[model samples]
Target: MTQLETAMAILMKVFDTYAAGEGKPDTLTKGEAKTLLEKELPGLLKAAKNQEEVDKMLKGLDFNGDSEVDFSEFVVLVAALTCACHNRCVKK
Candidate 1:
């Protein structure tokens, strides 16, 4: 597979792995989201400065107000982070 294809596959796998933990298998509950962020993006969580900030981030990610994150929402989070990192690197 191409690099982008591999990345997409990895994203799906990661979401599936975490989403399978509890609740519906297709979406992430708050607890599952927290675990996924804590384990998968520890650096991002650490940079948040406080638990409230992290909570706010999670709330923002739930764009549909469904109290859970579906795959599309998760992709937005990943894409936003990727953009932020890319911008930072480009500025240097």
Candidate 2:
């Protein structure tokens, strides 16, 4: 597979792995989302300054107000982060 294809597969795998933790098998509950962020995106959590900031970030990821994050919402989070990282890299 191409690099982008591999990345997409990895994203789906990561979401599936975490979303399977509890509740629905497709969407991420709050707890599952927290675990996924803490484990998979520890740097993001660390950069959050405080619990409130982290909470806000999570809330923002729940685009549909469903109290859970579906795959499309998760992709938005990843894409935003990727853009942020890319911009930082370009600056350097």
Candidate 3:
């Protein structure tokens, strides 16, 4: 696989691994999302201004107001973070 292909595969794998924790295999419940962030992206959590900021960020992930994040929504989060980081690095 190419570099981008490997990244895409890992994204799906990470989402699947967390989304499988409870409720449904296709979506992540609030708890599962939190655990995924806490475990998979601890630095993001730490960079938040506070717990409420972290909570607000997670709450904003639900675009359909379903309270659960689907794969597409999760991808948005990853893509946004990737853009933010890439821009930050390029600025320096």
Instruction: Compose the digit string of candidate 3's lDDT tens values, residues 27-72.
Output: 9998999999999999999889898998898899989999999999
Each prediction's TM-score versus the true structure? 0.96, 0.95, 0.94
State residue 19's C-alpha deviation in candidate 1, in Å: 0.3
**Candidate 1, position 55, lDDT:** 92
Clashing pairs for model 2 are none
TM-score of 2: 0.95
Q: Is candidate 1 or candidate 3 better by lDDT?
A: 1
Question: Which candidate, 2 or 3, has the higher lDDT?
Answer: 2
| Candidate 1 backbone collisions, by pair | none
Tens digits of per-residue lDDT for model 2, 11-89: 9999999999999999999999999999999999988889999899899899999999999999999999999999989
Give the alpha carbon lDDT tens digit for every residue of 33-80 in model 1: 999999999999989989999999999989999999999999999999
Candidate with maximal TM-score: 1
Which candidate wins on lDDT? 1
Q: Is candidate 2 or candidate 3 better by TM-score?
A: 2
**What order do candidates take by TM-score, descending?**
1, 2, 3
